[model samples]
Target: MNDTTRTVRLSVDCMGGDHGPSVTLPACRSFLDRHPDAELVLVGTEQALAPAAGWARCRMVIASEVVEMDDPVEVALRKKRDSSMRVAIQQVKPDGNGVTMADACVSAGNTGALMAVARYLLKTLDGIDRPAIASVMPNQHDGFTTMLDLGANVDCSAEHLLQFAVMGSALVSAVDGKEAPTVGLLNIGEEAIKGNETIKRAGELLRAVSAAGHINFHGNVEGNDIFKGTTDLVVCDGFVGNVALKTAEGLAGMITSFLKQEFTRTPLTKMVAMLAMPMLKRFSRRLDHRRFNGAALLGLRGLVFKSHGSADALAFENALNRAYDAARNRLLDRVHDRILATLQALPGAGTTAANEPPAARHAA
Candidate 1:
């Protein structure tokens, strides 16, 4: 059924995460509770969700088999014809057209499996070297930081990084509403000849691409500058981005825990904590990972947001909101068109990508 008369429907992979329905069910409930205009298609065994969900009545797509987190990507894909991750993607497929007219899919399952399934089912858009996972990191400033290839692909070349820079630029523009967001190359130092060959090669290529006005490349930035908002977008390989993100999350938890312990150590400290409760809460909210769980799998034909496995009801709700923002912004379309436009202006304007239209390249 059409859950709303306004926004598009979203397919939730109910069986893909560590907490499974415990996390997924509450999230689905929270999403519908807030956004009545968004419809959802839950993909997982009714039995699996029955215990966790109190008989949710959203449009349902029964996924008979579930690939557990420990299962291998290829092995799971081979057996589970009706797995939650696979079916969730099918609903968003333009060919399938099962979930209204939305160009999106979301899953909290095995990171590699989700990407593999999406790549096969959704396919990549034209001129997109590869699909990169784009994420938002809260900045120390009033705004948020953006990064791409956040574990979508472990290996990346200069061309891939160049493409990522372009996608990351557009994402920051659309998500942050920054017209010309500064894009940075994730590197060891500010010098032109720093780090390994890949970083050096990618660094030089990004400079050329940015010089051509594809993006506002901000040379090179150290790991510490990520939270400082030195650049609006940071382009890096999945390995580095993933490790950095995980470290930041761990540090946030440690910081909060330490504060709690210190505040309860003495009556005076407790009194001070009570007095500064509001400011502390605001600061904590800014650091909360729930608001930042969703990551967009960009360079694909559609919008696909991946949330953390431990994501609770709030994170799932935010994931839905993120999907709505991306779809309405025509994000993928804008990125593809921009890429083609840039390619057409190159020396071999008549070669490679010019022959195919945006829709044609994305038309799986």
Candidate 2:
């Protein structure tokens, strides 16, 4: 457990997303209202973040630039060195006294740029070759299933997958209060020989670590298993995880759209819609993607969370809340400690990596 007495400070990029300060400012205000022990370092242009200047427990950090939603990774890294996205991430870096400005960072910026800037600034934790993004998806059991590599590293080796599993487990255990979360290798079938060579090897590695008491391995799980809540965590490469996330969002939208269409299609159909309104509302709320807006960039030396580029005030607030929860639980320490312990138990497994670097851009 973490000591609740310490204030959890967060750095926020107020000008990164589509709506920019219009959306982020309100979210930050709402977050501060709920968390009396939290402080915010608002990073953006002077004029852009002027409104937050008077807010108590908040500090304004001037950023001359903003990373647009369509900005390329190279431009964000080289050209826009003073971008709010970059500066916000910088808050997590320790100062000359080894004291960090913020406990974590939250941004609704270009996913690729955020990941790139965060990795370049914080670097990866020891034994972690690359950082991965982990987020939760609503499942059937009235709970969320944690999944990782959600578009950070499109191509992953068996060892990289093992690293993701270790980081993801720490995330769940820290935030969700799960002592030993079960891990499932996302594959086409439940059998050990179902996936490609990389996945098969990953499964073997997961089993080895599980037997050594480092993780709780639940063998293999198919795509549908993710929605079934069959496991606490799902491990996969970025390509698959991104596709799955977008597909789930699309399905939710479709269901809500279909209901709207039926409500006004005809008078007789309208009556049926009215009868089902209560249940429909419940179902729609269950699938709203806004409730699960924050995605954690794991394996970094510090904590960084990415919110949807188009998130509104409510969604962005949820992202801030999630980051606050993780920080208060000492998520960074948990991830680093878990990785080190697991790697020490199985030498030559977590530190090794493939020759190719991660892709230039993550999935938008």
| Most TM-score-accurate candidate | 2
Clashing pairs in 1: 151-238
The candidate 1 region of ten consecutive residues with least summed lDDT is 355-364
Model 2 TM-score (2 dp): 0.94
Reference-based TM-score of each model: 0.87, 0.94
What is the per-residue lDDT of model 2 for residues 1-364, given as tens digits with 9 covering 90 to 100? 4688878899999997899999999999999999999999999999999888799999999999988899899999999999999999998876655568888899999999999999999888888998999999989998999998899999999989999999999899988999799999999999998999999999998999899998999999988998899999999999999999889878878877887996879999889988988988898788888898999999887899999999999999999999999888888878877777788678665455322321111111
Provide the lDDT at 137 for model 2. 93
Q: Among these predicted structures, which one has the highest lDDT? A: 2
RMSD after CA superposition, every candidate: 4.1, 5.1
Residues 247-359 of candidate 1 have per-residue lDDT tens digits of 98899889889999998899999999999999999988988888887888888766788877767778867876787666656576667766775565445532466334333
Model 2 residue 37 CA deviation in Å: 0.9
